[model samples]
Target: MGTKFGSVIHRADRGTFRAKYTYHGEVITKTFKDRLSAEAWLNGERSRVEADKAGITKWTSPTDRKRQEAAVKRRRTLFCDYVMDEFAPTWLNYATDGSELASGSKRKHREYLQHLTHSFFWKYPLTSITTEDINRWLADLDNFGGATPRKKTFQLLKAVYSKAVAEGAVAKSPVTMKAPAVPKSRQAQIPPATAEELQTIYANMPSTTRISVWLGAILDLRIGEVVSLQVQDWNPKTQTLRVCHSADVNGQLKSTKTATSNTTQPVPPQLGKLIDKACEDKRPTDFIVTCADGTHITPNRLRDHFNEAKTKARRPDLHFHTLRATSITAAVATGASLKDTMQWGRHADAATSIERYQRASGTERMREIANGIEDTLMGHEPTREELEAEIQKTKERLADLERQLDALK
Candidate 1:
């Protein structure tokens, strides 16, 4: 006779016991010589099933378990293969912050990945790469170029290891060191162009592209935004310009840099007229700035023209982006509040308007402040001309007060 205990079955004719179980629609069966062995195997299998159900393990069947183990081993054994073949492609699709990577950012990240190929541990397993290995690789970046490139490379590597950790490919990131800092000398702020210098640069630009200079200097638009403008973005009736998109280096139109950058700004009447003139015979879809052949003007093309214009104006140090700083500084000089300046520049915060765009006080404004300080602190007597001017100002105030009193009566 045959006896059965749970999923363990005894066959009398074969004098053997079989442990059999089904999990996730897959059958698992094994033969044992004795009943005790069959019972033991059955208990262990059931425990594995429970663990899998509880999310403690992924044990489904022996074949699936082997496949998962092999995949983990391959991820550990072939690090560069995992990175270049698997991780980089996936990581490039989405940024580390979980947003879709922009085209320009994707291109830059691809370049950064190339630097990792030159590392000594490029072929090492993910688990085998230690913090010391990452340090050595960073130290070797100097041979490739300057600190800026090295810093970017280090950041990319750190992001890679972080992805590996999240995927369970590595227990922890090996890139434990802080990022390398580029020297301050290389990060000095370029001074904004003066109003006179801006005029000279604009005058030197080609007639077809001169509007770009005004767009940048007056609207505080980025080069990308200037090149991305379309005929429809301008409202002649409302005298407003909409900034909703920017062009990448490849001249592909994309969303603006930030949510706040997509806004409707009041355009100066003069600039609005220029835009109306530019759109005279063009359709709404036509680009506002175009080359001679009527093709859309790319940022690179605008930049090349701007470079020539600046060179001719004797301001080779002036970049097209300096126009934005000039516009923000001009707004501040008009006694505009910080909030107004930030809105004019389309910046996210007032601190950026103050620290980055606004320049130091002009020579005349500083002189006025210095004179006022002397008068207040030194107790200097007013000159006869100043006293006479004060008396005339008082008479004007008395006249205004009397007029207001008569109106109230």
Candidate 2:
């Protein structure tokens, strides 16, 4: 009486022995801990086996043997080798970088696939994996990186296995064996600094380095473009900086991120003056901006300077991207159109600019509403005194509500 759905073991060596058997053209092995266990186990399964395989017979197991058989039948397969051999091929290529994916994308895929290989996906045969296997995998994904990541990784795996099917490896992708859903919620980015904070950073910067910093943040010129400025790229007449090329500290010419990335950026008036002054002492043969050592600025040195600026401004969250973001925000706030903002941000999409830099504070929104009401009611906007008084009253109301909530807790 072997375990349910396993071979019936008649007898074996005194120690545990496994019996190999064929069922429906597939081989399976049934293990027995001892001869007595095998005999007692098989004896009970005889009638059931005969009923299943034979014309007629009735079988019943010894109570403990029946329990043991049930336990063995219920044991699950769990292994890593199965995934590498059966699932990893057609995709999961480490040769290609996944950096182009948005933030946390790589981390999500790595964690989910890692757990699948180590936990269960590799343990079972490709045919044995079921809807249940995929459901559990997605749940773990949700716990790790939220529902969006789980959904994304699920789609990624599905694509990987679809490729596998095309490669004549797996007959079909098992990704749709389970499907999970995430709620619809928009997650917009919260940029790290305001224009005031950015200007504060620029104010304390070294004069020699300040224009270079401003060129990147205010003009959104990439490091290469900022350092590569030739004296002739500046057009005082059009107030534009033609972005045909940019350079490294060594003035090495390299490709911009893309073909569209090779466009011009118009210099705002203030930024234009800084650039004008910076280009004043230029060698006709030299770049518009140079480092303190008088060589073209390197990306690393530009970042180092940006970091110094952040330190001076006491804003640790500032990055080169933040400077570029500040430039976009300033332009947008001053009523630049989306197309112009895109040109200034050098963003692949206008939505990216909106996502990364736009800040609509709740307090400012309420203030605007109050001021508008005052203007309509009195045919004039509120005085500073009226606005201040309103703000103080709102603060007290908020404090009282917070105190009440805290007391309840």
Candidate 3:
């Protein structure tokens, strides 16, 4: 007699059990020595079938498993140790010379790696880590910051594991889990400073940054674009400024943020004359906005200068970007169309100009609506011709009503 468990059969005469299951449209049979062993093997095969049906992964063939097993036997290095010696150098080279990532971005990724280095679980063998372990690590990063940082850290870890997989250090990556969504902040209206307030700040600023403030507030130039302005970019005859280049935080010259940003915009005559005066005795190669020694003014220097002037003017919240937003808001308030505002502000989209930069304070909007209702209630007297036409229409309506009343009587 033979004990049977679905397709698994234990043959008493042979003292062996045959376990069978369907794999890749073919029947696979394995022999075991005991009935319990046959049932256990059969259950595992059925589980693999269900997992494949659910689209998790295809069943691993015995040959493939043996090959992976051989590969795992050769992996002697732990993840932390391997990353420190081999992966770190490879990643640095890829991040710096072989990739398009910026220097600032590379620095941030390295900082996140330090967080991983502090975790004890990351010191384990790379091949031993499961997806559950990766998910738990992501949960641990929730204490670091908001969803954005958690997501970024997870992405960095994924990149590291992918590199490991490519280098044959591991069979596959265990970081297919998704991170939390980044929450969006509500946009707030930022009111522009008045002309008197701007003048006060401008007067108090140093000579090096005075022109910078003027260009930013009047022309609505980004802080990067303002600092990158050279003598040649300005044309006194046409009164147009060609915004083709900008400087990074490190004072490295690069193209504008977008193609639309590389435009020739008109400058007001007042600001044009100020630029002309500053350009006096300076060559085309010389930067129009620079330090006393004629070097390209870094973003840090510009921010420091602006902050001092802002504190003096009593507008502690004012920033260089605020000046740009203020200028765009003023232009829109004074009957500028959305298209025109977008062009002048160098916005790639109109929604950014209308929604983000435009300033209409809550109280100010309420006041305008209240004033409109009051003006409607306090009526104006009609002209004589308008009164006569209204009286004639009223008489005709009354006559029709009287005729209807007589017919009813």
Candidate 4:
């Protein structure tokens, strides 16, 4: 009872044991509730002494041990290495559907990520980088490619660091600043072409490519979405086009971009006639728009056709996507609500509809807004007396509002 297996067991304390040993030339003693713990402590102390004799200094203080671990981590992991070895494989390829990222998206990520790995920050410790370093990197991008490139590069780095934080690889992201500002003058401004200009382009396009232009301008269909449509996706009786699939960046056909993108859009009679002309004598599996040899039209060939049409129309600034912008702007100008525009354009948010899609409306459209207000006020003829009384009440309300504002001041 006095001693048991490298521990002292007291007779009075039957369940507990005392452990004593020499560590770093000092006698270290501790009491343990069990022989196993006491024996473990004794063994650890003996190992530490052996390690010290072997020229390996074992850390005795908690602070010293933490410092040494941090140094070792910094030595092993660099920002570039972490992104290439860990983040890219584990996080970048991850998706909700358990599939890899779209080919086009991966290409863009790789392009922008180079801005980080090729810069001075690549050798920085993964966990040691601070907000100031991120800011400096963003600021230096101006000499490289100006504001837009700078913003893209910053976003890529921020995404990587955010993944690091989420996985507990780093405590927080060093990228805390807002996006770089792109001046309106420096931005690549593509104004929406008018319906007349679009019609001119349509008239000059070949029969096969005309269908593509019509779909883009009228239905706001993306180039990939238009080319991916099969003859069966069209309902001739209802004049509705079901957008179920699209071509990916690599020119391979896939499902639509988002769930909201898979929609049944109404087709105008003119556009429906165009589709019928293109799909004549074609089977249900056949693409509605095809090349001269009856093969599926790729995006590269579609761009060449669009370029020819743009030149013939004498609107060199117009690209294929300009037709989509024109359609969205035209939709807004025709008194469509923001919600209706979002649904029609397959947009996930109204901000994109208002800020990006809905371009500057002309003076005539401004007058249309005034006309709408006039119609609302003049819906029914009001008696002269009633109208005068309504005007007096409005004046009184304005006066009351001014009085309340003055009181607050």
Best by TM-score: 4
Model 3 spans with C-alpha error above 4 angstroms: 1-102, 105-191, 258-260, 293-295, 337-342, 347-355, 358-363, 378-409
TM-score of each: 0.65, 0.50, 0.52, 0.68
Tens digits of per-residue lDDT, candidate 1, 195-227, equal: 667788888887768889989988989999998
Model 2: per-residue lDDT, tens digit, 273-365? 887887787766567766776776766676777778788777876666556656666666676766666666666556565554445323454
How do the residues 1-409 of candidate 4 rate in per-residue lDDT, one tens digit apiece?
3232234444344666777654445555677887778777677766666776788975363345667787678556888888888766644544545656655656666666666666677888888888887777666754446666677777778878887888767778888898787665422267778766777888887677777887987898888898899999999999999999889655579867655678999999978988888778999989988787888888778878888888877888887877777787778777777677778888745766765533535455778788789979977577899899999999999998999999999
Q: How many clashes show up per model?
A: 0, 10, 0, 0
RMSD to the true structure for each prediction, in A, is 10.1, 16.8, 17.7, 13.4
Clashes of 4: 0
Expressed as tens digits, the lDDT of each residue in 1-409 for candidate 3 is 2223247676779988888765676767788988678788777777777887899978786667778786775375677887777667656434434644445555766776776676556678777878887767767654455666667667667777877888777878888777656554322334577777788888987786788887888888888888888899999999999898877888788767655678998988889999998898999978888887767798789888888888878888787888887787677667677667777878755766665433522355568778788779986577899899999989999998999999999
RMSD in angstroms between candidate 4 and the native structure over all alpha carbons: 13.4
Instruction: Score residue 324 of candidate 4 by CA lDDT.
Output: 76
**Model 2 lowest lDDT segment of ten:** 95-104
**Residue 363 lDDT, candidate 2, scale 0-100:** 45
Candidate 2 residue pairs that clash = 1-41, 1-42, 1-43, 47-58, 47-59, 78-123, 79-122, 79-123, 228-247, 249-296
TM-score of 2: 0.50
- Per-residue lDDT, model 2, residue 123, is 59
